[model samples]
Target: MKKIPVYLFLFLLLAGCSLSNVQHNEELEDAIYLIVSDENNDKLSLNSMTTFDWDKAYLFTPYSTQESITEQLGVDFKDPSDIDWRDDIYLLVFLDSDQVIQYAELERQGADFSIGEKQYLTPTDDIINIKHD
Candidate 1:
């Protein structure tokens, strides 16, 4: 009976330790604003969009620009002047204090987007709802 209680306590202790690993991505802890914009320059705030999958989104390295990110992803994105903003979308995540614009390219409409490392994907319904004016 004494051994049974000891083993049970050990199991609970180990379980708690494992649960510590399941946490929000530390990189996003200071995020204060998240917005999505279209080619038309229309903006929508996603700070209220609770269901967004932060796991599928990753921040680009600091000082990243459109040209640098395009080269990194091997994607031939259009020049800023050439792009028809009305047809496409971009997601921007801004951190606190400094207010840096974390660049995000919508790789495909209603599909997945890949940056240099992580894949950005949101539920199709969420995209549809947010894309509306």
Candidate 2:
């Protein structure tokens, strides 16, 4: 009976450690964000199921090669470091509940703008119209 109790305790301890590791991995995974833009450089879109109010738009970081910011955005982005257009200016589009969108520019820092790992969070709706220049 004592041996049986000892085995049970060991099994529980191992299970707890495994669960903790899994949770840590999940936290790391959630820390990245992917910023996707079109060829026109109009707006950046994210495949996220979570909806945000118009007021929350400013809180989002523009898609860029910055690994730290991208990580905090909870996106999995591709490494955008090697691309030639690293100096190019990029815009971020914010959409409102009424479908109205706004734009903001992202400045380049040398070859700093690289896309990181990409993971799809949710399905995004198609664009209707983009008015910015």
Best by TM-score: 1
User: What are the lDDT figures for the candidates, one per model?
Assistant: 0.36, 0.33
For residue 10, model 1's alpha carbon misses the true position, in angstroms, by 0.7
For candidate 2, write residues 1-133 as lDDT tens digits. Answer: 3356888999999997754321112221122222223334433343342344332222222334445534544433233332223434433333354232333344332212222332211234322222232
List clash counts for every candidate, in order. Answer: 2, 19
Q: Report the error of model 2 at residue 58, Å.
A: 12
Q: TM-scores of all models?
A: 0.23, 0.22
Give the TM-score (vs. native) of candidate 1: 0.23
Global local distance difference test of model 1: 0.36
How do the residues 12-42 of candidate 1 rate in per-residue lDDT, one tens digit apiece? 9999886443233323322222322243323
